[model samples]
Target: MEPSPLGSVDKALLTLDALGRAGADGTSLAALSTEVGANKSTLHRTLAALRHRGYAEQSADGTYRLGPAVLGLASAFLAEENLPALLRPALDALSAEVDELVHLGVLAGQEVVYLEKVEPRRAVRVWSAVGRRRPAATTALGRALLAAGPLSAGPLSAGPDGGTPETEAALAAYTAPGTTTDRLRAAVDEARRTGVATETEENEPGIACAAVAVLRAGRPLAAVSITAPVERMTGPARDARISALRELLPTVLPAGLAVPPAP
Candidate 1:
């Protein structure tokens, strides 16, 4: 004989699934009872348990729906997964289509950490590796993230000493001599206006890059970039690369990952 299902747990899960399918309008108790194949009294007890735990909610019309606890579960799940693994397919496809290197990065303090990299079959390739760190103010990936969100909470903001030493250090480390805070701010503004960020021989010599931030719920979660030789990243070629990114990235991104709207 087959092992029996955990009756209460199974009923609760079925109810949650049904409520999710019911959408924003929710479902009535009778409908849920019919859907889950449980008696009204039994299902009501399950729903009460769910509600006590903040997992299900009953509206004024007596309809049941998913509650805030579902979002908390999703957030916790995402937080535990390896981000690079989750985004690898999109980066692979992008690299193949653009015939260049693609990178996935996330901001950490004043630096951007390279979490993943996908390279095309080209002989001349950018020299980069996973786990590498770069200053956020000069790289395309970092700039894209900065442009997508506010700077007040990060190193860009003035410190208690009333000086932006961290910001200055980031720029000095990755940018050319004499590059100023105003210039970096201008680049970020340009990125916000165009829906992408660019750097031509700024972060790495003889290299150019263009990047866009990956967002979730209007907040920047990470950034993706295409990198190529400086020659292939200018004029018509550069426009074509950026266009490919804007058109193709959204199609491959996993659920909950989105590209910000273009200005």
Candidate 2:
């Protein structure tokens, strides 16, 4: 017999993927042959090999489905994950230490996606669970990362506007009872002034958040945040959050990434 153009292992893998999309009622060999653009004989032999390996199963009615071996691959990947996972252990320990909720988010368009979170053991805590999405303009982490975009002159600076149309629009979104758009603009100004951002009841009432940007190659890759009940997040406590981050920020940075602005 002439050799099959579809290699044994490659052909089996392709057939497995096709069966998943085809679903349980099953599909015909001819249909799979057409879908994979392989001749009938080659495709049949591939499916037989898959059945023997237990990576793909055939139904009583002759349909195909994925097998249990895939779980081993998925489990292995999840075991040694990083960043969101690597940061979680540290964030969790911090949450217990601070009695607050901690989060790590990455900028996504005009919003930020909550990628990792650590919550307090106590019942009373700030909301916004892991995987919760929040608008960038009105949140502390968003403004922190945004403000890291520009440098500041002082605490409450000269102009409320940052000379950019985008900055002004972002500044206009802080309208949550205690927080005004002007204040948010000022807060961003202050973060640029002080190198971090903090907010109280800006997005959610009776909640407070402090965020510091993680810079990479002159860009903010993501932000780290700490959230707590408004009362617990005030005075010296809030100030400490900012102070500690500034001190420790250099440690997390890589060799070339730790450059401070030269006078």
The list of candidate 1 runs beyond 4 A from truth reads 1-43, 57-65, 152-179
lDDT of 1 by residue, 15-67 (tens): 99999999889999999999999999999999999999999999998999998
lDDT of 1: 0.83
Q: What TM-score would each prediction reach against the true structure?
A: 0.75, 0.55
In terms of lDDT, the best-performing candidate is: 1
Q: After the best TM-score superposition of candidate 2, give how far the Cα of residue 30 lies from its true spot, in angstroms.
A: 62
TM-score of 1: 0.75
RMSD of each: 6.2, 13.7
Clashing residue pairs in candidate 1, if any? Answer: none
Candidate 1 clashes: the total is: 0
The residue-by-residue lDDT of candidate 2 on 180-252, one tens digit each, is 6667667777667666677777777788888877665566656778787887778888766655456554555
Off by over 4 Å in 2: 1-82, 150-181, 248-263
